[model samples]
Target: MPIDHKQTYDGNNIFARIVRGEIPSKKVLETEHSLAFHDINPLAAIHVLVIPKGPYVSWEDFSANASDAEIADFVRAVGETARIVGAEPQGYRLLANTGKRAGQEVAHLHVHIFGGQPLGGMLAR
Candidate 1:
């Protein structure tokens, strides 16, 4: 189900469970403020999801509530995850779906790194 950006953060969400070690994920990178892992249902050849450690429902919630250090660390973690996945060489796309309209399936703030081949257009026509 798509998440509502205005809704409160759900601690029991999938990403939260993964963070708590209750759910297993093929981890790609782990930082003080973020966690990167391979997406189980990958959209591309190289698809990864980077999520903040904090309880943020969306990017707006994260930007408004997270500490500066946490924000920086999360951003760096995403970049480092891309580099570690070897997606930086071919360039990549970072996507964060904020609401149901945008197809945000998780109630946690996560950035999807998509690459490893020609991605074509920004959106399907």
Candidate 2:
């Protein structure tokens, strides 16, 4: 686990504010429980991040308190975004970096959905 496991950062804590027009973002999709936006620095042709509208700094924070319904809603939103982004049939990669060692930079819990091209090689890099 990350050293900052005890710390909790809600969507409204920062980034979500940007998405909600409280700040600003290169936004994409928004739902009641989740939000999607293009990665500021993308690693793939279609790199969008799907994040829950909750106060969870990382997956640990979310998993510890989030309900099954919250989890389901997040997945469903990702699936819907995938279809909308044309990564449905071809599929995509959903990446959740749990900690700094795992390459989670932003601190907020988010799943990166990317594909529409070769992904296997990208993972090894």
Winner by lDDT: 1
Runs of candidate 2 with Cα error greater than 4 angstroms are: 1-3, 10-14, 121-125
lDDT scores in order: 0.95, 0.78
Q: How many residue pairs clash per model?
A: 0, 1
Residue pairs with colliding backbones in model 1 are none
Point out where model 1 deviates above 4 Å.
none
Clashing residue pairs found in predicted model 2: 10-55
**What is the per-residue lDDT of model 2 for residues 1-125, given as tens digits with 9 covering 90 to 100?**
34354555645555567556796666677877788888788988989888887777788888878888888888888988888888878879998887767777666788889988878754565
Per-model TM-score versus the true fold: 0.97, 0.82
Best by TM-score: 1
The CA root-mean-square deviation of candidate 1, after full C-alpha superposition on the true structure, stands at 0.7
